[model samples]
Target: MTNALVFLDTETTGLHHDRRPWEIALIRREPNGYTTELRVFVADVDLSSAELMGLNVGHFYDTHPSFRTDSPMRLPAGDEEFQTGPGVWLAVEAKAAVLVERMTRGATIVGNNPTFDVEVLAAMLRRHKLCPAWHYHPIDVVSQALGFLSVLNLRMLGDLLAPELAEDLTPPVKSDKLSKLCGITPPEGDDRHTAIGDARWVQRWYDRLSNPLDGDDETTSVQAQ
Candidate 1:
């Protein structure tokens, strides 16, 4: 398998079925420590709905004011100033092409709970008349952690391997929270909602799982493998 992993995350307008992505962040990391990160602000959606989803104008203007003017339609200017009728459709198409090209190179997509990201990306690609080119099976860190803990005796595993994750591993344990699984605090600050920040956290959690600190037993050691 390729040692390249693509950590992806998206910030959407809403969680509704018809919602669309406004920002996307993809980080490609290699075993040699070479990393390439891409963050694109897609301008093909209803900004009004994005406002309702907590992505207000102030948020964009403060962080990326360029998105307002450089997007499909130039904001602060009227709809008459729109450069394209479809609103940045070409930009969306270009970004989608980049994503497809990178994924097709054999890099596996990884995310905290990647299903939503994959779904949103797929939807965006279809909307732009682009094909979803990545592998059907993406690596979901949350799901992997949950499945690994489901069959094991948490109490025993905790005592035998990761005592830090013990208390949080109570019976009927139900959560994919990285903080709970890794015994680390949830990421804060700019990392809270941004795609790149969240992707970094996902990568951290995955790294911990790949090289566990303490796991001598069969079950726990298998997790490291």
Candidate 2:
């Protein structure tokens, strides 16, 4: 088990391999219970695909700080000194630099669809000649919840299975639903598709699974401090 975990989430333009992340969130948790957070809105986003996909991730059209010229946010080249904070506006280059500085390279990642988050972040990092060296293993919240459900003999991942068989099928349980089935209360409304909201959901879900009460010994702690 990884003693350090970085719960990550990204709100992107679309669902395909060509998707671009416009918002990113990270919550780094250390064994001694120390926590740090960063949330930023990446500027220079090409929302063409987002328009095609009808994507308004995190209510981006209305909430992004960059959309308004007078908004106070940390900018890499401005007089504000570029401090990290939630809901700030940042250019991709600046965002990549800050992410490289802030990301824990050794922390195992935890997220729902963690690979998607990793790949998206990796693309942005590599664009600036930076590489992600986080711990090789990642915990997928959906998979973890599904594992718990599998032990009860549930069979509802037909969406994945049907893909192998080349059939069009929708699973009864999506990732969020699976998280909820395992006792995670996801955020509501505007926060639904936001990066920080989802990252917090990952953290809450993992803590719930790892620290069950009533003498439940089926789960173990993810930290070692």
Candidate 3:
């Protein structure tokens, strides 16, 4: 059977599902290949301009160039701002329904933390009185990996299980870790706080562990075969 695995990531306004999405990233890997898509559902929200300034927006734009240029992903402006309208929620619910429906055909949803995502999406669908066409079962990557490497502590186990991935910085850490590990110092650049970019980095680190190259250059984009 061809396994369908999906890695999903989301950024939202605070921690509440009712707050709406600030960003969403989904990375899918199948027997054919791997592909990723990202969307920024809202922008310039109710918070003050200064408050918005302090947000730790991940590298959403830098990694996902296509999304950066997409029109529908852009949020509206002014007091006539976009709230969680029925149509918008309907679209999300529809997509979730499709994703869930596909899963019933034997696909597995893999995520870092799927409990929250599934809960929120389920609640949203119920709130809209729409029955999604998929199941709620999800394979949590972090938990499974932890269980697999129960011998080591969390930090050490992460490094041991995926040493190459250890190079990438996980929130709050400088992005320099990856390059620095490779002994290559990257030039000065601002990181775009986008989810797609973060997923790309995570994927890169995962890739590096499985198939390492004998290169000293840090900027190599290793495309999967």
Which candidate ranks first by TM-score, i.e. highest? 2
What lDDT does each candidate get?
Answer: 0.59, 0.67, 0.42
* Candidate 1 residue-wise lDDT at 48: 59
Give one clash count per candidate, in the order shown.
1, 0, 9
RMSD of each: 8.9, 7.1, 9.6
Q: How many backbone clashes does candidate 1 have?
A: 1
1-225: candidate 1 lDDT, tens digit per residue = 555777788777777676677666676666565666665555444555454535652245434423644542333433211123211221343454455455434577888778888887887777757777776778987766665656554556666655545665443444434346555445576566776577767766676666567442122101000
Tens-digit lDDT track for model 3 on 115-169? 6555654554465566544335776544443333233244554645346555323
The runs of at least 3 residues in candidate 3 whose Cα sits more than 4 Å from the true structure, single-residue gaps closed, are 34-36, 43-106, 125-135, 151-193, 201-225
Candidate 2 deviant stretches above 4 angstroms: 46-51, 68-91, 152-172, 214-225
TM-scores, each model vs. reference: 0.66, 0.74, 0.46
Candidate 3 TM-score, C-alpha based: 0.46
Candidates sorted by TM-score, descending order?
Answer: 2, 1, 3
- In angstroms, the error of model 2 at 171 is 4.8
Summarize candidate 2's per-residue lDDT along 131-176 as a digit string, tens digits. Answer: 6888878888777776776664444544433233322224545766
Better of 1 and 2 by lDDT: 2
